[model samples]
Target: MRRIIYDVAVSRDGFIAGSNGDVSIFPHTGDHVDAYNERLATYDTVIMGRHTYEFAYQYGLPAGAKAYPHMRHLIFSEGVQLPADAEVEAVRADFTTHISALKKEQGGDIYLCGGGMFAGLLATSKLIDVLRLKVAPVLCGVGTPLFANVSERIDLKCISSTLHESGVEYCEFNLQ
Candidate 1:
């Protein structure tokens, strides 16, 4: 089964973005970005909430564009509009049902490009297999959080941790 990886960047204070949804604070230079770019090859599908999908505006991805060019992009949105031939696809199938089907498919892993709420939902449901976190040293006191309002504490077993030169700590945690 393909694992669902919540591979995300986080601030030291646990926020994924600034209060205005700006993720520019994280270190975009050096080994952190290089390692992240390399990690992208492990995923064939990129799953995200509508906001995260649309958030690509900062990267110049228009409404009809795909969030990640090579991967299968699935956005969970009830009311997002897109062109018929758009590279991105909205989630028309049932959430758990579709995800369960995806897990059974023979392919590379799927990534949960998060926006907090959606990741929280999956976390609570025990759908998130592993969390690949790149923790930036800076803190966003108030912002879109890394994990928001989860029902219970999902214990994590650390798989590995590496400290990068840019003060970023990359860690892999599997849910237990």
Candidate 2:
């Protein structure tokens, strides 16, 4: 089965973004970023919530456009409307059913792009297979959490960890 990998950057306090969806505290350029961009190349599919997809608008990503051009995009949002000819797919299907079917499909891996609520849903459903987190040095104190609305704990086994010179620590984990 293809794995759904939740790859994201988190603050020391465990926030994916600051209040108002600020991400300026995270590193924008460095060896760690280079590694992340390289890893992005390996994924053939991506899935994310509407908020995460729309967040790219500030960075000039056109609405309905694929955030990662080379990968197939699936945005999970019930009321989200996209252009008729949009390259990405807006999925209003049942989350568990859709994700389960996607996992059975042939693919390298599905990149769960960034969304605390979405990640939490997948984690609680035991659907997420892997987690790759880049822990930043700063703390947001209060912001969007790493996993929001999780109803139960999901145990994980550390697969690998790397400390970059930029003080960013990359950690990989698998559901246990």
Candidate 3:
């Protein structure tokens, strides 16, 4: 089966974004960004929440288009409609069914680029196979957590770790 991995960057305090939904605290420079870009190349498809999709489109889409040309992008949104774009698709159905069908058709790992709510949902349902997080040095006192409302203790094995020159530490945790 293809793995569903959540590859996100979070602050030292475990927040994915600041109180104002600001993700600027996440590292985006030096070897960390290079490593992240390289990691993204392994996936054939990228799945993301609506909010994340919007944010990416607003800030990162242009750059992402150049970096991940071969990858298909799927955005999960409840009611909002997606523009008719060749590079992006909006999925409005059940996540499990859609993801399963996608896996059967695409036949490669899926990267879940997320906002915390979607990650929390996937985590709660045990759908994520890996949790690859880049821990930044900054701290967000109160904001969206990396895994909000995740009740069960999902065990994970530390696959690898790397400390970047920018004070960012990348950690790969495989669901065990």
Candidate 4:
């Protein structure tokens, strides 16, 4: 079975993005850049919440545009419609069920691209297999926290960690 990895950049305070869905606070470069890209290349599918996709509005993707031509993109929303020609498909309300079916398909691991709320739901449901992160130095006092709305404790076992000169730490953990 394939695993779902929440491989994303995070703040010291555990936020995925700043308040109001601002994600510009995280640093972009470090020695970990290569490893980050490597992780991206490992997944054949990228998962994103509606808000997360909209956050990258600067890089406008018109209808029929393949955001990641090399990989499949899955956006979760209730009934929001995408452009008729958009390459991506909006997932149905039965997200968890559909996700399970995706996992059973022949493919590499899945990447949970963004949205703390979406990650929280996955974590809450005990569906996430890996919690992988790049910890940046910035501190967002108020922001969308990693694992937001997850009230219960989810234990994790650290698998490995690498600290870079830029003060960014690359870490991976397995759900316990």
Local distance difference test, each candidate: 0.88, 0.93, 0.81, 0.84
Q: What TM value does model 1 have?
A: 0.96
> Counting only residues 3 or more apart in sequence or on different chains, how many pairs clash (N, Cα, C under 3 Å) in candidate 1?
0
Per-residue alpha-carbon lDDT of candidate 1 for residues 1-176, written as tens digits (9 for 90 to 100): 89999999999899999889988888889798899989898789999888887788778888878767789988887877888888888886587777888889999999899879889988887889999999999988999988788867789999999999989999999998
Pairs of residues clashing in candidate 1: none
TM-score of each: 0.96, 0.98, 0.88, 0.94
Regarding lDDT, does 1 or 2 come out ahead? 2
Q: Candidate 3, which segments miss by more than 4 Å at Cα?
A: 60-67
Rank candidates, TM-score, best first. 2, 1, 4, 3
lDDT of 4 by residue, 1-176 (tens): 99999999999999988888777788777777778987887889988888777666667865434566778989888855678878888896888888888888999999998788889888888889999999998999988889878998889999999998878898999997
Score residue 132 of candidate 1 by CA lDDT: 95
- Candidate 4 lands at a TM-score of 0.94
Q: Residue 9's C-alpha lDDT in candidate 2?
A: 97
Write the residue-wise lDDT of candidate 2 on 1-176 in tens digits.
99999999999999999999999989987789999999999999999999999999899999989989899999999977899999999999698789999999988999999799989888888999999999999989989999999877788999999999899999999987
Residue-level lDDT tens digits of model 3 in 48-128: 887777776666565224225677888777864554544577788798778767766746889988878888888887788
Q: Each prediction's Cα RMSD?
A: 1.1, 0.8, 2.6, 1.4
Error of 1 at 144 (Å): 0.6
